[model samples]
Target: MEVIAIQKSAFDGMKNELKELLEMTEKVTRKYTPIFKAEKWLDNQEVCLMMNITKRTLQTYKDKGLLPYSKLNRKNYYKLTDVQALLEAGQPYNTDGNGFTDQ
Candidate 1:
């Protein structure tokens, strides 16, 4: 009877430890899941989609200084903020500082 009690106690302790491990894993996953607000920047594919351009077109824009981008480990990245600024500046509806219009 004592041996059975010892075995049951060990199994209970193991089960409790496994449950704690699973709870910890759940917490870690929730902490690291991606949040949409944290990812406003555009990668190459995102920029292509935004501008309706091909990868080659994006390269040309980068080469011509017409697009804003950054290099991370030799890979290019763009920001939505820069795209918005470019669109605003190029729009015909935009006015100069002196209130003069392009039209």
Candidate 2:
């Protein structure tokens, strides 16, 4: 193999550029990445308990678009705000004569 040498000044400049690139990347990530309140994010069990509904009913809510959820790692998560909104709406959970709630 042939030995090649790079100028120390050139190497230092390249290193500085790389550092700047890393800092810029971090700034962009912070700017663009979605910020979620950890407490606002509720897992399935927490939502079920809070809503006083079973898991099956929760699935039904999802199927009918009554509740919005995000699935991660094969587990479902819901926003507390959305759940509270549903409770306040007082329409989605009430079933009609057809046994399905009106959307």
Candidate 3:
């Protein structure tokens, strides 16, 4: 068996690696935590961030009732489940009732 010397650089490298591992573990843990999933409703900014959409696009959805929402004190709140279902359902572009693109 050979003796391995522990140096400051090696120790620091190990510490950094451990820290990175811990951070990744925390991220994975947090992903399945109930606190994250407890948010049944989402505001506009959160919806935009999750859907990678601009506020204008979100407004368009709201205008067309594509994304169901409820207003509380004049503020709109969308259901997270509904948003997820909409994504899973793969909604198509709206038509102008005459089979023409609404665009």
**Which has the better TM-score: candidate 1, or candidate 3?**
3
Tell me each candidate's TM-score: 0.46, 0.55, 0.50
For each candidate, how many residue pairs have backbone atoms clashing (under 3 Å)? 0, 0, 0
Candidate 3 lDDT, 1-103, residue by residue in tens: 9988899999999999999999999998887566446768899998878876667777888898889997867988888998898778864454344534455
Q: Please give, for residues 29-69, the per-residue lDDT of candidate 2 as tens digits.
A: 78645545444778989987887766767788999898999
- Model 1: number of backbone collisions: 0
Clash pairs for candidate 2: none
**How does residue 83 of candidate 2 score in lDDT?**
91
Best by TM-score: 2
Give the lDDT of residue 87 in candidate 3: 75
Candidate 2 accuracy as TM-score: 0.55
Ranked candidates (TM-score, high to low): 2, 3, 1
Instruction: Please list the residue runs of candidate 3 whose C-alpha ends up more than 4 Å from where it truly belongs after superposition.
Output: 1-39, 91-103
Candidate 1 per-residue lDDT over residues 1-103, each given as its tens digit = 3544468789999999999999999997787455325556788998777765567666766876878787766887787887777666753233446544344
Evaluate residue 93 in candidate 2 and report its C-alpha lDDT on the 0 to 100 scale.
64
